[model samples]
Target: MSTEKIPQIAFNPKKNKVLGVEIISIENLMSRNQKTDHSPEKAHVLKFNMIVLFTGGESEQLVDFVWHKVSKNTVIYLTRGQVNAFKFNKNLKGYLILFTNKYLEKQLNALPQTTTIRLLTSHLFSPKIEIPKDLFIKKYFHLFYKEFYKANETHIDTSTIHHLFVILFNKLERLKTNQLPQIKNTERFSIFLKFKELLESEYAKNRNADYYAKELHITYKHLNIICKEVVHATAKQFIDDFIILQAKRALINSTDRSSNIAYAMGFEEPTNFIKYFKKRTGYTPNAFKKIHS
Candidate 1:
């Protein structure tokens, strides 16, 4: 069933919110889509999680500038504020699950911090997972999808949705843990996750490790300890890596001037930004763009 056609999609943003979750397909959402650029017009940073489960056909999703394959049994996961775009086949068949942070955070809080919860929250982990398409897999989505629409016909039973959500999460955990073992449940892991959440929201303005440590009510030394224990890196290195990644994403995806990109990224001078980028990446912003563009 493999084809040689390259993935393509043109996108204009649309508000795709439902009561809590929006399950859709590219075929159904074609109005906001098009085919031309292998890339999106610009990078997309969503405020919610977008999960695409490919059941048929072939395509690619440009997630944070990495083109991930979308074929049978492939799943793409995009976390909030992570860049993504559709470079995809028109013939592809898949279910796209979009749900808000509020919805996901609320649900996870009600459950224990199991492997499933870790997979759902860890943003640095791989964003795509491929699993076999079988009844066990189909059952999870079917129950959730059926209950979602049935509630629309009758009445919304939040519990029904949550029950199905738990089952589906476990299935996904199995796939993720196979690739990356579940992180231990410890104070360090908890601290690292909290720091990560804060960084995702605050990385743009507050790049200092001390700022994050203060916000998390932990010492900077303690934060470094937690980060090294979990990710094998220092807290400051993690923050800088995130900043550089966002900068690179802006440089490669947008046509804005380098100075503009630097200013938007909170640098007072373009020279400093350039130096910082080159120091971390060994290439000037323009040079990096030359390779990507």
Candidate 2:
């Protein structure tokens, strides 16, 4: 896939609109433009949020360089700026809902520090959740699909769409809490979510717990407390993991040399970089390269 040519489709009212939303079955999404489009299986970055809800069948999706295997009743959420590539089964049965962040962001514009959207944008971080399909829940996707395809309104009442998303996100959050391994941790780890959000944006420039703590306007101790509460790890360890993961991504996906990568990751001493990477990953830069190669 050409990274530069990642397809990003906006809500085209002329095509289909539930006011910034569109829903298509996985079968149709795969074949909709096969005659005219090239590389339909290639990965692309999204400019809007896309939610794929599967009723049955199995498939895998690459999200931000991580591959997630999903099956029946699995829900995969992809937000703007995330790279997504699909590898679907022939009998892929699912609902693909695409919606613009523009309208949703405004309604959820309050800062993470200010209001509790209660992680309304939480899916941006935790993207996959699985729950068995029920007639009650399957109805939303059908209703959304119906509304989106039938939307002929010139000026759609966005409130209806916004309410739909609120219900959907809230329901997913509840399921995520219940279905995830550590049920109790989700309740008190709101700060952990903010930490991840900030780290994704700031990790390259700042990998220190102190910097993240300051950005979140919380004491370093408080940040560590939240990290332990949520991930059973220290804030420093999380920061290190974040930086190391970014370095690994660069090593795997980029053509840059180890020395250049070390310097780029703010390693003033190259040996420190090697030691740090080896400490966590058990592989020196060159060794990791050879293995991946």
Candidate 3:
């Protein structure tokens, strides 16, 4: 006569509303089950305005162009414009730090390029440091979590939270300095960073390597050499990939007509856009929307 009970599914990040630092929790964000299956479609798309920290569990084999796995006692920073997916096991326990771009921008506004904030922005989406599983890092993480929780509870007084956040940033910066060695700088690396920044700003209007070269004050040949050296891809390939990424984002986030989207993204005509998109993605824009939707 006894009825069998159904098992509960873990909390899904995709189903939840985006919360800022003022109203989020580490425990509340995680699932009770250690092992959970997640599809790429269920991956949480981080809107560019916020930062998030996640720990524990191996991620699902989803397509991630820019994802990083942190070591124990390490904190991974995800700036704007990067997306990733995760699959957590039961022992996955970590704090997810959420903050706004505006929060960091204010401080960075006064700093020069060599400063930590500005340099960090340039290396955004690139994992830079790996904190060891030492007592110092453990204590810092604990303090960060405590201060973050206190900030969430005292949501009305942001001044207190700001101070706490500054402390957190200082600790992270110290760890970054002490734990990680500097990566070698090369001409190709410098060019790649410049190209990435330019691509972010001008991907809609300019897809040609020549145009990027003009902006960077370098010849097209030099640009190509640099890109090939650093990324092992041609400048055209990088542009194509950037365009495809934008197309994918538009397809997922908007319900705009295809023609409008095409024009908005700098295509001369809808048909041309369709052709280019299909060539890169193997699906028409409409088809892409349907598949992702």
Candidate No. with top lDDT: 1
| RMSD of each candidate relative to the true structure | 6.7, 5.4, 8.6
What tens-digit string does per-residue lDDT give for candidate 1 at 1-293? 11112232222223323455666665665544555343343345566777777777887787765777778788887766667667655577767777766667767755545544455455456788887756366556656666766643656577877777766766776677665533565777778778888997887687899999999998999898878766677999998988888887777657777799998888889999999999998999888777555
Off by over 4 Å in 1: 1-18, 31-42, 109-112, 115-121, 133-135, 146-162, 178-185, 194-225, 248-257, 260-268, 278-293
Please report, as a residue range, the 10-residue window in candidate 3 with the lowest summed lDDT: 1-10
Q: List the residue pairs that clash in candidate 3.
A: 34-89, 34-90
Error of 3 at 289 (Å): 2.9
lDDT of 2 by residue, 1-293 (tens): 11233354444544535456666888787776466353445555577878889877777887765689888778888776566777866877888877786655665642232223333433225578777656355677776666555555655445665666666655665666553434255544667778888988877677789998998889999898877766667999888877876676566555667788888888887798899999988999767655443
| C-alpha lDDT values of all predictions | 0.70, 0.68, 0.57
Greater lDDT among 1 and 2 belongs to 1
TM-scores of the candidates are: 0.69, 0.68, 0.62
Error of 2 at 281 (Å): 5.5
Write model 3 residue lDDT over 171-230, tens digit each, in one string: 555655543323355555667777888888898888888999999999999888877665
Stretches of candidate 3 exceeding 4 Å from the true structure: 1-23, 30-75, 84-91, 106-131, 135-138, 150-198, 228-232, 269-275, 278-284
RMSD from true fold, candidate 1: 6.7
